[model samples]
Target: MSDNLQNDNVVIESPEPVDTTLPMVIYALYLASIVTGGLTALVGVVIAYVYRGKGPEWLDQHYRYQVRTFWIGLLYFCLSGVLMFVLIGFVLWLVAVVWLVIRCVKGFKGLQEKRSPENVDTWLV
Candidate 1:
């Protein structure tokens, strides 16, 4: 009886694995930013910092894509302002589309049992 009680009382504490929240949130906000432009991008930036480094491939891909998207959008806007040509805009659009497809493929690969960094912890939650 005493052994049983002692066994029950023994606390089995295990440390939690490093969180992958940063990557996840960054990717999420990246998408939001793409959809809504700068405002969403701003939010995404904050989230990315907060999340920092999480072990989620989607998050990484999203962050990368979002950054690319943001820059491309800015370039497009600037080029449009300067040249005002529909053809230029179309070319920029094509670039963005290709990047999105590549990012999506990379993200899918990450999801398919790709080992991610273990010590990535951007946010507590």
Candidate 2:
């Protein structure tokens, strides 16, 4: 027998349909950032930026929300860091953590329901 054989015809399958997978993954990454020291959140925000405007309008809303969450969260963190000198930073840090959790959870729920996030423009949950 020959070492290799040629086929006369080949078939290829189409890719699976797109869904909320990316959004869910991003949310998971954001949550994991709590333990990962914000590294995962940086990755999640990059994914959100890269995939933004490339899906259904609803998904676009999610991407936008994710992007905003990253920037706003960063601002909160920085502010809290500066306030650390005054001792109020501890409280602000806790508030920031809670805010991030609420935002991620809300986004996850919206994605699960296949709907656009409510008040996507809001800074608070």
lDDT of 2: 0.92
Where model 1 places Cα greater than 4 Å from the true spot, the runs are 1-15, 53-86, 104-125
lDDT by residue for model 2 (18-120), tens? 6899899999999998889799999999999999999888889999999999999999988998999999998998999999999999999999888888899
Question: Whole-model lDDT for model 1 versus the true structure?
Answer: 0.50
| Candidate 1 residue lDDT tens string, 21-96 | 4544555554554466447657755664555345355456445444454455556545654553656766655555
Q: Which candidate is the best by lDDT?
A: 2
Candidate of highest TM-score: 2
C-alpha lDDT values of all predictions: 0.50, 0.92
Model 1 clash pairs are 20-55, 22-51, 23-59, 51-122
What's each prediction's TM-score?
A: 0.47, 0.85
Worst 10 residues of 1 by lDDT: 116-125
**Residue 63: error of model 2 in Å?**
0.2
